[model samples]
Target: MTVALMWEARAVEGRGEELLAWAKARVLEREPERRETFRAPQDRVLVITWWDAEYDAKLPELPEPGDELVTRTVHRWRFEAA
Candidate 1:
């Protein structure tokens, strides 16, 4: 089975471009080593990411360092493929 996850989140305050770049690097270099990944969308204030669908369940388990949005503007999606 293959899993795909679509994530959408915003950067807070000083965690803007720097944070986005970091996330992009992780998506481009690291995450795919574990599974699969789609290129990130570097536009607007939202940091969009895609990776293994199963990774969604591991979100809270990961180190969510950097800016954590305290607003309701964050949106994400998880999709699984057979």
Candidate 2:
């Protein structure tokens, strides 16, 4: 039974680009089979990442200390084929 890991995060003002870059790189290295990854900043945009058919995955690297790239929230959802 394979699963998908859904990662959604929002960064504080001004730090969006760096965080987004980190997310893109991390997914490539950590979960090469990711189905999707997106980052956009509007009034409060979201960075959405999808890891496809995952059995287990290492934790995504955390932002460095003093980065202040807080995670307003995080979510995980199970995927079921239709």
Question: What is the per-residue lDDT of model 2 for residues 1-82, given as tens digits with 9 covering 90 to 100?
Answer: 3455555666677777766666655533464344566666531323334444445645343233233664565445555334
TM-score of each: 0.40, 0.54
Worst 10 residues of 1 by lDDT: 32-41
- lDDT by residue for model 1 over 1-82, one digit each (tens)? 3445454544555555655565455533244314322333433233333445463455421224344632234455555665
In candidate 2, which residue ranges exceed 4 Å CA deviation?
A: 27-32, 43-67
Q: Cα deviation of 55 in candidate 1 (Å)?
A: 9.8
Angstrom error of the Cα, residue 58, model 2: value is 9.7
